[model samples]
Target: MTIGQWYNEAHRALRTASTAMGRSRALAAADINAAVIARSAIYTQLARATALLVGGSPAAEAPDRARATAILARHGQSLTQLYVGLQAAAVVERQFPASPATAVAGPARSLRRAVDAVGVIGDILASHVPPGQTPRTPEGLAVRAGGGVQSGLADIARLTSAAIMIDIALPGWLDQRRGHLTEIYRPAAEAARWTANSRLSAVARELIALGRGQPRLHGLDVARPPLNPAPPVSTADDAVAAVSAARTWMWQNPSELTSVHLQLGTQLGLAVHVLSSTGDPTMIGGWRQAAIAAADLRATSPVGPARDTAAELTEVLRWLRSIGKGNHGEPAGRHLQQVSRLNSELPIMAATLHKGLSAALQRRDLFVKDEGVLQRPAGSLVFRAAERWRPAMRDDDVVQDLVRALVQGQDADSRSEHRSPSSRAFPLPPRPRTPVSGAHWAGFDPPSGPAVRRSR
Candidate 1:
């Protein structure tokens, strides 16, 4: 049976035993049986948990087991509770003085307390089960305690011939949270870093440190090799969202351009493109929405910078969508050109962004001012954010290939439509509004580069 089914059945048995207090001998006997089922079922789960944590039989993967072991060895005191619970349960079975309905309530209560201890340990270990391995904790993950409601988790440490065994480990809520693997934590981390906002960066680091087994949310030391990638917990979509935010900021302050801002935008765009190509749902979900949001945020803003930024981002999003879907006809050629241009410039912008981030790390010039992390130089936050979006101009040949393939696919589709001939009756697509290119090395470039340090 599935582990869930097994767990449910066992839980029902415990509930039956716990509530059996009618003064009859029959009710007392039934309670004992129910308690036995509960104990056996839970002990089984505990065994499975130990196997998972210590890498015992059934799917002995080395790395995961080792990691689990280290976590347990370093901070696993929950086992003591498990042992105490088992001892309590053994006492319940060894003496049935309270087996009569008149005394059943007291016995049931003791049985429940022991069961609860084991259950909590189960949950604690569950929390640490690598998010990837939770699907396999049932099946042979079975065992039981005698009489009713519980068993000794001590079975894991057999005692015989004067030899005591305590090899396996199971983690409990030992120290503070050493690490975490969750859905939202990763994206939150990436967004924190790219903004360079002292607050966000600090939050991101805490999340990063959690993965490395430091749960206090403090140590996000970005190592100097290969660009400390957004923490592994981070999905590609988080990275996309980060870029989209950067792009929107640029749109709001087109007049302000800096190497960091420009390079960031370019790299963000490139990261999105590369990630989308992978088709992994986590990386691709909500991507188109992110593009649309960047445009909408700007479109609703004020007159000069707001509307202007809106217009620019809207055009970029439009191009991104059209290219992705392989939209055809006259616009296809221009879209191809835009894609080609962005591609060529991608590398130069990437190099610039890398250099900027590296320099920021070395110079210790990340965003933050007043003694409190919240305090910053007047207007620097927005000004800095705006500058981060306008990347230097360049081109890429890889995009040319992607665009060419798309154009070819569009061509094939056009032929398919023409051969059918019902296509002419359809309304023509609206002409695209010209993109309001950002002010950079391109046109209205502003004071940028190395000045963020002075802000610090």
Candidate 2:
């Protein structure tokens, strides 16, 4: 079923539970059985929705996917609390048979409130569902629901605490439910951080190499080194700090260097902004400042290689800024944006550097000939070095491949947009098929389905 369908089913089941719990008196055996069946139905639908949302299949847009996952989490937690309240009610009926009326009132009241809380969550989910979809609810129903559900949840919390006083085991069940959600989201979070750090470290190393090599080749005396050794990167924050430090180093120790060096510094600064500014509006100012700095550098640079390099840098920065302004509403989208920028800009930067280095080497070789030197040609050494660094900077196909993989995982429709026509002519290798068993589902383990495989 589509995620929308599953969510609809969950809402229907929640309504059934609410109806069954309408009576203020203690729940009879039939009422309890109905509630249990409804709970099981809701659980199944919620699990299906979550699996579909996070699975390999292309689902909704990134913003919709994020909202759907949050709805699933909130409803799942509410369902758990509802079931706990039901169980506590049953315990109260069994423990105080003499005054069952008063004993069950507290639990029944809490169960009713819990059902209302679940209804409120369903309203929120319904708000995001597209119009004309099956099993739709009134649009903007959540706002009309008075937004008091948060306070209702606090009341439920107090009631659950009272139940806890009566049933010592209640906390264990709540903890188990919380732990299930933690386990599901933790791996995805860690994987995202690891991917960001890896990309950041790679770019930092490239920039450092360019900074050190360019000055020596041009025979320019350095006032200060362009960059120090890259700091150890164990986290995304550490990677950001390292990239920021590189930018600071470049700015603090300004020297006469090639336009390629300036381009690399501009790219590095932009990378810092993209990595660190996931959702912050203030970071846009920093990104614009970096662009302005590059423009200023370009204005002062001489004609020839410097002018050409600055022009390329300007185009790259403009493209990157356009991407930054796009509707990348999630952190995953921001990461993919970073990858896309790198894949597009790296080859141009490398070519510019290679051209400048080659020209410098040719000039040196001519000077050597005019002086009647008997040493080996400088072209040999420079070409050898170029050959080594050329593949690292020029061969951007590896980065393209990474971007393809990431786009596949995040948004499959964007794959075509990331690749050029020539690159698209060559297909990527097929990925291995892996079975997604019930064990892989985050909160609830539903029945297993067919294996999922990804290919280009």
Candidate 3:
């Protein structure tokens, strides 16, 4: 070939390679996105199925099963479409000489968008049923009328696995925002510590009682005047003595009444978390009453830190209630308002528990903003659960584990004490490459030449 012709051919080949690489990158991005979307659809279906099957099985059988099946069929169609799109993208990606460089940014964005969209869909599905029939109480009319319990749970397990897949990929996106969170958490933690300590102290003093049934003027040793002029007697000291007696009574007599302190503490803690996150203060009054009840238990006993703190906690809670009503300036900081409102809603049985927990979360929110080593180990547990569920496609044990992890993080002193999953066995059929679809569905794509595989 002539020199000029050879040079032209080289330039042509280079241009072709660049074009091919760009296409490869685009396809890879699409494949990642498609996989996420498919998984989301599957997760949604499985959740619906499980809810219907488990929650409704006892109430209604035939209609419920039929309804659950129908729902699954529609979801199956969406899954098929997602798989087809991903497979096509994957095939395209494999043909290019150099895989596209744009994949780094594109895949992350696609994955996030897909998962978020599924969340919206889940919300919509939830709405189609009724309110208050969430994971906590799934046996509502819709579930009972639509499917059997076994199938419902099976579906739930399926979708939960799918959602985890997306959530698993979220940490990288969150890492960029870690620095901005530090400034927000520090002040909050300081305020929480100050608040919890002050409350505990107040409780101790109120229950103190001293004078009741005292030995009548026991003969005093008159040998010498006490140095530093024995500290003046105070009502606070008297209150402490009285409360101590009450404490003695409870410890001595187990048969008289049930010791519900620990149980009450747990209830109070949950109430506080619910109230704080939801930003409502109406609940604190009940908690105030609970603190009083606790205080009342030791009304005739000597005062100690626990009693004093309990009293202090009540006073702090009262103050919080007042602030929630109008004591604070208009439009307090959002977090403060939330904390206040949560304090307001305290049930009568859980005041101390709520107070302690609210204080703890508040401290953590402010003091530990580094996305600490704790967060990683915790996240790793979640990731591992997700991984375990991927191939098995089982949702129940995985979802249970996820919830357990969340609870552990919130309640445990140290995240280092990781709890293993309660059940190691997953109950689900192996994943099928081509999910079955129904006639009414519109999104299914015929299988592509190359198969697409979802990442574990």
Candidate 4:
């Protein structure tokens, strides 16, 4: 079948699955199994369709591709919500098995069909690749081959991260939830674990094959060492701690913030490309809002490192907008190189931000009422700090100033004589004074400091 034909097939399958899911919602107690099955089908089809569309050929008609991409994104989000709902239902059902015997038959049949449909879609995409395609020049060949290797490595990293989340992180999180594990859910949970492990192993082998097939690109393989290590952050506390550590590191190593911003720009540019490809207005609007938020952060920031970081963020957002408008070539390639250089740090930083956001949302009490005001600015600061601490940019003055200000602010807030309206409005939380390289400060101070300024 042609790529367009396959897209039609995917569309039809997705529609059928979505209809089933919708009908399942109104199903009686005995048919809850059917509802779960329908939801699984919907999730599978949406995921498959979205994946295929993302990797779709550039030759496909723009309008059709755009429409399909929009559908996939819209359905993808809905199916994710449904999947979450299914998980919640599973918890409820585990305690009181509403027709346990009914679970295996209907769900098994529905899932089999869904899996077969996905396999067919994958096969079609895989077979549709043009044969005998080779780069015209050695440089072109290297670029093509090196991109494959980088993509393969990225896939491996993503898959490994997902596997870790499924195996270690998820179970740990589930343990925290009440009534998460019951005898009825054990079989399904075990099956999911087995399936995830099997898939991970298969994907890993494929990624290794992909990497091996690509010719060695000399410059690409030479990775610069990281300035500082980024430990994995799984929880809110861990994310907050990582942010703190990153802040201290950046303060001591201010020059590194520029490199951090460059890396961030690359990542954001890539995201813009992906979102633009989807042609979904809502998604594009959300991206624009993020850019606007960055701009606002830049406008409101003080004349120090915070403003500098915000300005860098705004510049990146503008670059990303340009990339979306098809103004990419050498500049995009340069951005990609920056990403490659900071490959080790980028994932950790992304993960930390994701976790931190999730933590903030889940525990509102941990953040102030207007947490949105601080989120981007604080994040920029942390990113700048982290990048500075990284070996690529080893300057620490920016981060040191941040630490000094934080420490001084806290101290000033403590002294009644020094309290001011501005400080009162945005009071620094009290923290124990600790010295950063003989300079006294509060909380997690960097290893060293320059001249300390007393807060009025």
Tell me the alpha-carbon RMSD of every candidate: 26.5, 25.6, 32.6, 25.2
- The sequence of per-residue lDDT tens digits that candidate 3 reaches over residues 278-391 is 422322332333333322121122134334323433333343344345444654234343352222112211212222222222222111111113233543554222211111
Give the Cα lDDT of each candidate.
0.29, 0.29, 0.28, 0.32
lDDT of 3: 0.28
For 323-436, candidate 4 gives per-residue lDDT tens digits of 445443534333332222212222223222222222222222121112122234543654222211121111233223333332332232233232222122212322215432
Clashes of 4: 14
Give the residue spans of candidate 4 off by over 4 A: 1-271, 274-312, 322-352, 355-456
Against the hidden reference, what TM-scores do the models get? 0.21, 0.17, 0.23, 0.19
Shift in Å, residue 384, candidate 2: 52
**Residue 19 in model 3: shift from native, Å?**
24
Where model 2 places Cα greater than 4 Å from the true spot, the runs are 1-34, 53-456
lDDT of 1 by residue, 381-442 (tens): 64222222211111212212222222222222223322111111111111113322322222
lDDT of 1 at 75: 30
| lDDT, residue 120, model 1 | 49
TM-score-better candidate, 2 vs 4: 4
Instruction: Give me the displacement of residue 409 in model 2, in angstroms.
Output: 21
Q: Model 3, residue 291: what's the lDDT?
A: 31
